[model samples]
Target: MTKILTTQNAQITTAAVEVKTLTISGKQVTLSVFRQLREEPLLTEDVTLNGVPWGYVNYHPDKCGNHRRHLHVVWQRGADLLRSTVYAPEVAKFQSVWAKLFIEAAIAEGLTKRSAESFGISKIQIWPHWATHPHLAEFSYGGVSFQAAIREDFADAYDNNYVSPYVKEKAVAITGPHGDAGSIAALKLPVAEYLAVWDALTALPHLFIAV
Candidate 1:
């Protein structure tokens, strides 16, 4: 549709209407290079576009200009427009202060659109996979860094049988700081899910039974 085009600095001086996204680099943080902040579990902070508190950014073609365009994504915060312009002299500097607009940046710059939704935002400079993930939420519960993983998580393993034998055995193994992983939650399960687990476990013996 017909949309107003703005400069990467948020200025309305641009005559072209194609969509483009501006990126800023934020503090360096740990994360998977292949995923966005909403798709990786290694980041921990909040970044916004203009003023919108967005989990990620996206790009689209502009309708006002023949070949001219601007970024189409919004800030993660609530506002639709930025109060001030964000200036980045060097691409690397911008890459260090704000999260990179993955697929959108390329599209804005006339690149590939194969990964528009896969772009990333920064939480401590790294990409994450979900909104309520470790970075967005407080990592420490009582007094832990939240990266704690241990080996005892394997004790409660089971066979789901919903898929192939190997696939059914797939499970979660979250653990604490040391190898002394906490025991399985002894608490009761919801009626339906509990029954489901029981049924799956029941089939285990027979499937594994000696012939």
Candidate 2:
């Protein structure tokens, strides 16, 4: 037996892990904690404005064996990748404190521009947590319209027809903006599933609406 010397065998034991997203000017900054790792906890974060990458950080444990925790930085530096070494005995505690400081540093970098709404987002509507409703955001990409709305069914009395309740509670739908079925690629996905897709889309050069 080789004993399988790998960090993948570890597990995360945190009570709660929440994703914190910030909208500064028109840019979007996301802060997420991964306290579920078996060996150590880390913060995975990124920042984008106008569909452009301002900064990003990701933890790679397998490369350094949890001693010299490797934090990868994603930004234009003429190179594909670069890393910074973080040596902290108390890995979990260090990551929690580091996340806050990193956010401050990102704000000071002066990357946040105006609001995404102010730029060129007319069709999509973005609703934050503070708002009465919790619709994340909705917009069209390449003529494929997408919307994040409450996952409820129509009530009785709409032409005397009752719609069936959704099997999964919350979800989003992708369709054509104005009933163009020919070129429309309609899809409905749970909020959790769709949000991940939205996050990946933000990495593109002009896809992220910034709202």
Candidate 3:
């Protein structure tokens, strides 16, 4: 066999190996920091990193980190996420909205494709373990048309539906198949579409009526 090397092969391997850098930036800013409205909007995604549909939980212990707490979310890999309401300082709070924002932000940042869903496989997903410990949040779907069975059917009503099978350290994770190129694309999408997705995700909150 003749040994021939091409630069294109290396690029392909690099892209496949890296996938995309998901940087969930941890914020240490003082509460004095004025909450800034999103200067830039994001795109809502139907699936999470593990490819499962969005769902809600009530003050569940975060599976990503330890000795701490946070909301279970699938927001952009490296983006900073801030929400509307929170009570305690160390107690982190979030909802499925954060998950929607994460996907939208990825698209807005030019990290995802227009039809990224075409290439992505539906599977369960989880937030980072080291950074976010068990989280505490409440989720309710009343205004939005959500099928309650969706979450239960995903993992046969398993609680650890988002856990990764590769992660043996976490004893409570589900199984699923995935491609390296889930949504991140070699090409870019229009800004309008990006904003539209973000808007779409915001509508989710409306589905919840105050109890």
| Winner by TM-score | 2
Error of 2 at 175 (Å): 8.6
- The sequence of per-residue lDDT tens digits that candidate 3 reaches over residues 1-211 is 8757887544443343422221223433232232231212122323213222122112222223343332222222244442322111122121333333223222222222233234231222323233343322121111111111112122221233232332322211221122122222222212233333334443332211111
After superposition, candidate 3 runs with Cα above 4 Å error: 1-85, 100-150, 155-211
Q: Please tell me which model should have the higher lDDT, number 2 or number 3.
A: 2
Query: Which residue pairs of candidate 2 clash?
Result: 11-38, 12-36, 12-37, 25-114, 26-114, 26-115, 26-116
lDDT for 142 in candidate 2 is 32
Superposed model 2: Cα runs more than 4 Å off = 1-51, 59-147, 151-161, 164-183, 186-211
TM-score ranking, best first: 2, 3, 1
Q: After superposition, how far is residue 178 of candidate 3 from its true place, in Å?
A: 6.4
Query: Which parts of model 1 have CA positions greater than 4 angstroms off?
Result: 1-15, 26-34, 39-51, 54-211
The model with the greatest lDDT is: 2
After aligning candidate 3 to the native by TM-score, how far in Å is the CA of 41 from where it should be?
Answer: 19
- Count clashing pairs, candidate 2: 7
lDDT of 2 by residue, 1-211 (tens): 7677579886778788544432345555333222121231112322111222333334443444535332332322233222233222222122222222222221222212232233222243334434534333343323223333321121111112322333111111222123222222222112233334345533423211122
Better of 1 and 2 by TM-score: 2
